[model samples]
Target: MTIQIRQFPCRRDNFGVIVHDDAGGPCVSIDAPEEGPIVAVLQREGWHLTHILTTHHHNDHTQANAALKARFGLEIIGPVRERERIPGLDRAVSGGDRIDLSGLEVEVIDTPGHTAGGISYYMPDEKLLFANDALFSLGCGRLFEGDAATMWASLQRLRSLPDDTMLYCGHEYTATNARFAIDVDPGNLLLQERVKEVEALRIEGKATVPVSLGREKRTNPFLRADDPGLAEAIGMAGADPVAVFAALRERRNGY
Candidate 1:
């Protein structure tokens, strides 16, 4: 039951992840942003790559899938609807489909706001979520295909996960996200504290992600879209959850 995570740098400050079951032998690469870092980490850790899990069709997330597959012969798992978008599709899965990796069960969630066929991986046993491009620490993904309502529903699905779930989003955008969170919720003491803490981490050249769901609920403006205070901060009426979420996301897009 040993679960490990390795982070790699990718396109224009994005991130790629490696999730491994120490006893399962091969690991799952969350998104193939680049090949060099993935190769280096796999060689260093001696972890076999069993699968490549894609969240969407964005090139930043799927560009290296073919190369990785050619090199390792690993399975590529992506949204069933995105068969044409993603390269080397060994398995096409949809929402609620469960895949077994050795002994661990991974649940696929169809979160389609970021992309038409975006999907997220949730490992309840490890309390880990590979929430690529959809939800960040304090921000949500831009509306590329889906509308605000769809994004809201997608985020609400993520909010229903256990509070302790560790969220691993697809980019190193937490510092900027925290700043935006503060702007949207200046009255949130938790966000205030987190801004300072995250700033310090950035000063030290560290990552501020793998942020807990509990913390996101308490401090993240995107996740707190149901709060009245946040709605007002964005010049909206009380507790319009969808409105608040949409406003926050739009602001972050501009931020």
Candidate 2:
């Protein structure tokens, strides 16, 4: 089954993703930051809203959840740990819990770092990962609730996905993240080149999202925190994965 993904930018840099099945049986909205865009996309495609999958309980991610659920009678699914925080959570899930949407089976992946109960939706058949604040293209999310160790481990889970997996993160922070990446890895030719590409995309008012896992592996410092070069840049002597990850995240938070 073919999967269709539509990313809508909302409130500052937040991204709301809309995912649909091939035959259009069930469409799931990921992180409803606003009602208008999500509704417009559903209406435009004539897709039935079956589920609202929330990665975290942040207002920018779940503010429109209640409105959308009421308007479309959509079932809300979120991490069980944050059920009280996210509105309309009909189904509370943790890592490894599977939910079927039409013929698509979405596997839950607990990624608690940006928030206490953040989780990503992985569609193995479509090789799509809705990795909200847990993972971004050029950087990882800030440690709002969980610590660096948790965020580092959370990112490791995303890094373990297939190289060609399509990563649908929860924000449009690629360009700014790329800038920070360049700072972290100045000698990284791939990141230097990507910074230019990202700048061009931003200049043209285009979104730099849904970046491939392979692409991110090659340029994103957060994903390459285990690389020897990356470890050295952070003043560490060896390929100490956690140190690299911590340094990159700390630098990004200040960036």
Query: In candidate 2, how many Å is residue 56 off?
Result: 0.6
Candidate 2 deviant stretches above 4 angstroms:
none
Local distance difference test values of all predictions, in order: 0.86, 0.86
Cα deviation at 76, candidate 1, in Å, is: 0.4
- On a 0 to 1 TM-score scale, where does candidate 1 land against the true structure? 0.96
The lDDT, on a scale of 0 to 1, for candidate 2 is 0.86
Per-residue lDDT of model 2, residues 8-100, tens digit only: 788788887888876756788988899888888889888878889999998989989989888889899999999999888899999989998
Off by over 4 Å in 1: none
Per-residue lDDT for 1-255 in model 1, tens only? Answer: 888889877767888789888876559899899988888899999887889999899999988999999999899999998888998888899999999877878999989888988999999988998897888887789899998889888888898999999999998888888887887788888889889989998899888888898888888777778877778877896757887777777878888
Models 1 onward score TM values of: 0.96, 0.96
Cα lDDT, model 1, residue 136: 87
